[model samples]
Target: MTLKSFALAAAMGLLASTAWAETKIGMITTLSGGGAGLGIDVRDGFMLAIAQSGRDDIEVVIEDDQRKPDIAVQLTDKMIQSEKVDILTGIIWSNLAMAVVPAATAQGKFYLSPNAGPSALAGRGCHENYFNVAWQNDNLHEAAGAYANTVGHANSFILAPNYPAGKDALTGYKRFYEGELAGELYTELGQTDYAAEIAQIRASGADSVFFFLPGGMGISFLKQYADSGVDLPVIGPAFSFDQGILQAVGPAALGVVNTSQWNKDLDNPTNAAFVESFAAEYGRLPSLYASQGFDTANLLLSALEVADVSDADAFRDALRAANFDSTRGDFEFGPNHHPVQDIYAREVVQEGDVFTNRLIGVALTDRADAYAADCKM
Candidate 1:
């Protein structure tokens, strides 16, 4: 063989050498503790997609981060060194992502985010190996702000947790609301009791309320708010109204408006198949996180079909091409490798015995993250 041909053969051999070209993925996500529902949904959705694709060449090692940053950091180390995973994904919290993503990518592992798009990573901290299948941290809240104005909320009181995602949540809402601020508050992460906050909301003289609590925090706050006699309309991002926690919140979430990139009722073939397949496999209705997880898996699978992960540049290009159909419809990655898609308003409603969200209308069309401009890559 010629020298050039020999070089090409060696490169191909290296690419094909990964356990006979079987892709290994490491998923570190919160599977236990307070906000476990979100991570469980993400994991189930991703695994369901992989099963449906029938790709035995793809192997996954899943671990529970337990919603702890220190433990997440340790898992990242283990996944990269011990498991020898080619890719890492399934982080749900911005805090956990922040602790894990930078180090993981720096160590040469491609990281796909099914949830948690911290603004820091979207902008200055952005890496070519990092991709977010879910909306940016602020996309839904920015949509919520616009929707709040459309529905004639003039003076709004907003609240979120005191974490990175929480900080992004309130900022996103204020960006487009074009309304007077009646009050703004930040609560503790994983806080279950909101009696103090609800009392403040009642006395804030606000015409409307917006809160960004997710998982159990949302369940506790909504039920408490319902009994507090604070009759103002409540609006939030999909995290607060997702199917995983809505039933737990009971009737407190009904008629509440939330913003999201995907809903089950969205009209499209990709979404239809995903919704149906997810229900059949999981025996439960999927949440927005589930759709994001499914999309993340399909994105990786699409890249795997076109370019081997051993060729990082080629694989990154394939991922950027975003050839897969998303449940969100018309989805694409912005310059920062984050989703650029339509954001819709959804209203919490009851379908038979199950409580869920129904699509109301599009709040933002073809929206990208606010920090995309700051992404130098």
Candidate 2:
């Protein structure tokens, strides 16, 4: 072949390779240990979103931090430096989110939070570079708190682990609950036994109980709560009674009320499609964790369409605009860098072969977060 022809052919090959290359999105989560179920859901949901969008050029590099803060930070740093990832996402725990988000943002990569909205990040710690597709730590609990007031549950008991996220959950509930608090209990983080706490709750004789315990802790509480035979109604945030825990708790969790931003039975066109596709792909119903993950992918894709997102500042600005079709219907970022969305009160129901949650009512919709005023971002 002629030298000019050879050069032209080589250029064509390079162009084809570049065109076929995918946009790499670094996803770090607690893939193993206790939080594995939630991580699996997030991964599956992100993939489902990508499939539905029909965007072949996007890719996700998933890493499991095992719910460890140090591992999370290391994985995030590697993703930013070695992988040269275009975007960063995942993280299930508030501590992990706190550990990694700053580094990811300081490096000027867009950090999309699929879960974990710590109060610190919701207030003055908010950064333009960080965007949370999930509600703030308090939003869901606040909805429950409002529901408590509406239901005439004048006296209530609150329980949570002694952590920043746990504290935020209770504070969120208090934002809307004007009634008298029967009792408040804060246990050590990751404590399994709730026998002593259950005794206290029974003694308190509150009309309703609120709690925040995700993963194994949630399972332990649900099983114990059922065994305790507490006559009063049970209410709390959704994470503790999530799909992951439902399998463990069995029918013990039935009739439980929880507040959340998303449920498997939303019945919206977008959510229905997402749920159907996710269940088919993962062989299980999608939880709120998965819903947030799907929304995060959608959010990133929307920003990518608006602008190239080749640089950090441009991507951050685009994300701040919150231009995406969130599964929750109304998708917008509040000043606190958390989602301004509806919170639903849902009941755990046994749906045919699987246990899933159905919405009881919309407790709050398009509500501004309590801490939004404190967030200058």
lDDT by residue for model 2 (1-377), tens: 99999999999999767744657889998788977988888888887888888887887889999999999988988888888787888888889999988778777777888888888887878877788888788888899999998889999999899988888888989999988889999988889999999999999978888888877888888888888888678888899778877878888788888998998778678888888888888887788889988998888888877766676667677888978777887788887678888899999999886677889999998976776788775
What is the alpha-carbon lDDT of model 2 when measured against the actual structure? Answer: 0.85
Error of 2 at 185 (Å): 0.7
Clashing pairs in 1: none
List lDDT for all candidates, in order. Answer: 0.93, 0.85
- Displacement of residue 204 (Cα, Å) in model 1 is 2.1
Once model 1 is optimally superposed onto the true structure by TM-score, how far is the C-alpha of residue 27 displaced, in angstroms? 0.8
- Compute the lDDT of residue 95 as modeled in candidate 1: 87
**What shift in Å separates residue 75 of candidate 1 from its native position after superposition?**
1.2
Which segments of model 2 are wrong by more than 4 Å? 1-22, 311-314
Error of 2 at 198 (Å): 1.1
Best by lDDT: 1
